[model samples]
Target: MTQIVQSLAEISKPYDALFCDLWGCLHNGVAPFPEAVAALQAFRASGGKVVLLTNAPRPAKFVIESLERMGCPKDAYDLVVSSGDAAQDAMFAGAVGRKVWHLGPSKDDGFFTEIPAEWQGQADIERVDFDDAEGIVCTGPFDEINEVPEDYRAKFLLAKMRDLPMLCANPDVVVDMGDKRIYCAGALAVLYEDMGGEAMYFGKPHPPIYDMARRKLAAIGGVEDGRILAIGDGINTDVPGAAGEGIDCLFVTGGLAHDQFGADQKNPDPELVRAWLGARQTDPRYTIGTLR
Candidate 1:
C-alpha cells in the first residue's frame, strides 16, 4: 500500500538526501518542468542533498550542459551521476574488447572522445566497422526519433552470429521526448538478448550505477541508508533501484506511467496507481501526481 501524497514536503523531513531520476521527472528533453524544478530547489533549501541520477547514456557534464541550455539552474541539485560514466569505466577496463563498433547518433560521439582524465591513458578503445569489431558499444539508435528497436534486427542477428557482446549505456526502453516516445539503448539490448546476444547494462535497477551514486554521495556528505529517499517517475528504474538499495521511493505518477492513471495530471487515482504498481511487483514508499 503505497501512500499517495500531495507533495514532497509532507514526507521529506526524514530524508537527508535524494537519488533522483532526471528524464521524465526533471525535464522532458525539450525543457525543464517548472514545478519539478521548484520541488528540487525546495528540497535542497531544506538542507537535503540531491543527486540527479540518470540513464542518459552520456557523461554527467553533457547532461549539465543540456540543462544549462534548457535554463535549468545548477542550484537545483548537488551532483549528476550517469550510466554512461559508469559504462565508460567498464569499457576502459575491457568490459567489451578494444575493437568495438559504435552504434549511436553523431551527437553522442563525445562518449568516446570526452572521457574522464583517469581513464584517458589506460583506455585504448577503437571504434571499428561492424564486421571487424571485437564487440559492440550501443549508446542509442543512430536516429532515435525516427527509428525503432525492430529496425536493427538484421544487424542484431549478425552480432548474434558473431557472438559480439553489446555494452548498453542507457537502460530506458522508451522515454517521452516532449510529445513523442522514442526507443533507447535498452530497447535494443532487450531485443539483442531475445536474439541470444549478450547485452551488459550499467544504468538504473543495475548495481553498478547505484554503487557509483553512493560513492559520489559520500563525497558531498554520506547520508545514511535509512535517511535517504529516492524520487522519480521511472517505475522501472526508480522504484526497483530504491527497493534494491533498501531505501524509500517516491513515485511520480505523472511521468512514464501517466497514461495508466488517465488525463488529470495533478490528481492521479490511487486505486489505479496501486493496481498498476501491484501488476509490476513494485511497492514504492510514496506516490505523487508530480514532483511539486
Candidate 2:
C-alpha cells in the first residue's frame, strides 16, 4: 500500500532530486497553490534539487513567465523543462515537412515564431488542404474553455482522410480549470489516432522529455534514478513516466484526478485512493492530499 502522508517532509529524506509537475501540482492554470509552493521551497531549503517538468506546449520561458504571473516563487524550482521545448527540434527541422497546419490557440503562436514554416491558422480545420500539408502540430484546443473533445470529431475525420500525421506538443489529456476539466492537445491527438491518423507525442510518459529532464538533473550533481523522486497529479502521465524512468512517484490526491478518488483539496478518502490506484495497477511510493 502507498504510504499516506500529510506533509512531504515526512518522506523527503531519501530523495535528492525531484521531477515535479507544474499544472495541477503547483497551480490550477490560474493561481498558485500556496501549500504546494511551500513544499517545493522546503524541499529546496533541505538541499534537494528540483526540476519543474511539465507537458505544457510552450517553451520554458513562456512557462516561467506564466508561473511568475501566477505568483509561483522562482526559488521553488531549479530548472524548467517543457514538451514544447523538446518539440522545437522537430518543429524547426521540419520533421514531418515544411508546410504545416497549426491546431491550437493563437496565444501559443510563439511556438512557431522561430521556425520558418508556413502556418495555416485554425481558420478552417475541416476545409484545410490536408494533402498539401506535411503534418499538424497541436498545442491545445482552439477554444479550451468553451469547447469539448467531441467538437473536433469532424476535423479529425478530415485529417484522417488525408493520412496526415500529428505532432502532439502536450501529452496531457485534460487539465482542471478551477472546478471544470478542459480538454488538451493530447485529447485531440488521441481522437485523431482513433480515426486512423498517426500521432507523435512529445511530453511526459514519453522518452524525449524524460531524457531532457535527466540531462538537467545530471548537470546539477547527479542523483541515482532510485534516489530521484517524481511528484505529480496525473496518474496517466506522471506515475507511468516516473515508473518508466525507474523513479518512485508521489501521487498528489487533490489534483486533477481528485474526484475519481473521492478527494478534495483539503481531505481525501484513503480507501477510494487505494482502490483507484489498484484498479490502474499503479504502485506509487507515496500519496498526499495536497503537495504539502
Candidate 3:
C-alpha cells in the first residue's frame, strides 16, 4: 500500500535529490503552479538537488527556455534532462538511420537544429517525405490539439509494410494543456505498435532516460539511488521509471489521473487512489494530491 501525504516536506528529509516531472507535476503546459514551484524551491534551499526529468521531445536547452517563459523560477531546479537529448543521442548514433520522416510540430524543430556542441560534425540527419524515408522520428502528432493517433493509421500501416522503425521522442500518451487534454507522441507510438509497426522509446519508464538522468546527476553531485525520490503525476512514466531504477516515487495524483482520484484537487480520496493504482498495477512510495 502507498502512503498518502499532503506535502513534499513531510518526506523530504530522507531524500537528497528529486527526479521531478514537468508536465502535470509542475506546470500544465500553459503556466506554473505556484505551490509546486515553492515546494521545489524549499527543497533546494534545504540542500537538495532537483533534476527536471521530462519527456518533452525538445532538447534540455529548449526545455529550460520553456520553463523560463512559464515563469518557473530558476532557483527551483538544478538541472533539466529531457527525452529529446536522449533520443537525439540514439538518432545520431544511427538508431533510426539518417534519412527519417519527422512527425511533430514546428515547435520541435529544435530537435533537428539543436545538436549539442559535442555531437557537431556528425553525419547529417535528414527529414524526408514519409514515402521516401528510411525510418520515422516522432515527437508528437503535427497538431496535438486536433489530431488523434488514429489519424496516422494509414501512414503507420504503410510504414509497417516498409518496416521503418519509429523513434519516439516523448513517451507521454496524453497531457493536460490547461483544461484541455491533448495526445502526445507516445499515443501515436502506441497506435503504431498496435498496428504491427515498430516504435522505440527513450523517455520515462525506459532505461535510457533513467541512465541519462543518473549521468547528469553524477556530473554535478551524485546522490545514492536510495536517497533520490522521483516526483511526477504520470503513473505510467514516472512511477514505473522510479520503480525500475530502484528509487522511491512520489506520485502527484492531481495531474492526468486527477479526475479518477476525486473531485478535490488538494484533498484526494485515499481509497480511490489505491484502486486507481491497483488498476494500473503500479505502486509508488508516496502519494500527494498535488506537488505542494
Candidate 4:
C-alpha cells in the first residue's frame, strides 16, 4: 500500500518537518544532487522545517563544511544533525577509565575535539596497541575509495584477541560515492562483532541519534512526531530509525539499493522494488526513485 511518488512535492504540504538523510539522498559523496537540493528548497519554501540528519561519523561542523564544498548551499536546509554530534555526549561518560583507541580516517579526528577519553592510539590502517587499549572507536575505513572490509582483518583480529569492545560511529556498511560503493566504519564494526568482538553502534537505526534529531525538530516547534516525515535511501537505517521514533518514512529507491532492483533516479521497476522491500521487512509509507 506504499505510495510511489514521482516527486516529494506531491506530499510536502502535509508535513511540518522533513528529517532528511544526507549521503544517498542529498549527494553521492562527490557532489550535491541538484534535483535533491531543489526539492529541499521547495519544501522549505512551503513552510516546512528541514533538518539534514546524517549518519556521518564526523561532527556537525565538518559535515557542514563538506556539504558546502560539495555544492550544497546553506539555504537547502535549516540544520545538520550528525551521528558524531549525538555520540559526543556518550563518549567521555562511557569511557570512565578505559584507554580507547580510535580507528578511522584522519578526517574524523573532530570526534576527540570534546570527548574526554584516555587516548591509547589513533591509527588508520595500522593495528593499534591493543594490549594497552580497553576498547576501539571506529569512524570509518582509512581509505574509503580503495579499501574493503577485508583490509581490516588484521585490525579486527587484534581487537578480538584482546576482547576489546568497538564503538561504531556510523552504522552504514556501504555508502554510494557517485557510481561506486565504498565500505564504511559500520562494515568494520560488523566484521569485528562477527569475529566475537562486542560492537556498539552509535548512528541511525539506533535510538540515540534519532532522539537527537527529534529534539532538534521539537526546538523548531515541530513537536508532534506524526507531523514529521523522514526521507532517506537506506531501508536498514532511515526507515527503521524514523519508524522507531513514530515518524513516517519515505524510502528513496535509487541511491543505495538501486542495483538490487535495477532502479535509478529517473526509472524504477515496481515489482523488483516491492520484492526487495518485502524481503527487508520494511514498509515505508512512501517510495521514490529520488528525493525529487
After superposition on all C-alphas, the RMSD of every candidate to the true structure, in Å, is: 0.9, 4.3, 0.8, 4.0
Order the candidates by lDDT, highest first: 3, 1, 2, 4
**What is each predicted model's overall lDDT from 0 to 1?**
0.91, 0.84, 0.94, 0.82
Task: Using TM-score as the measure, name the better of candidate 1 and candidate 2.
Answer: 1
Candidate 1, residues 63-89, lDDT tens digits: the string is 899899999999999999999988888
* TM-score, one value per model: 0.98, 0.91, 0.98, 0.91
- The CA lDDT at 261 in model 2 is 56
Worst 10 residues of 3 by lDDT: 258-267
Candidate 1 weakest ten by summed lDDT: 114-123
* Per-prediction tally of clashes: 0, 0, 0, 1
lDDT tens digits, residues 107-216, model 4?
Answer: 89888764423333432222345567777878888888898888889878887887787878899999988888889888998888888888887689899888888777
Kindly report the root-mean-square deviation of model 2 from the true structure over all alpha carbons: 4.3
Per-residue C-alpha lDDT of model 2 across residues 182-219, encoded as one tens digit per residue: 99999998888888889998799998898988887788
Native-referenced Cα lDDT, model 1: 0.91
Model 1 compared with the native: what TM-score?
A: 0.98
The sequence of per-residue lDDT tens digits that candidate 3 reaches over residues 1-292 is 9999999999999999999999999999999999999999999999999999999999999999999999899999999999999999999988999999999999999999998887899899999998889999999999989999999999898999999999999999999999999999999999999999899999998999989999989999999999999999888899998999999999998998888877898888999989989988888999999998
Maximum-lDDT candidate: 3
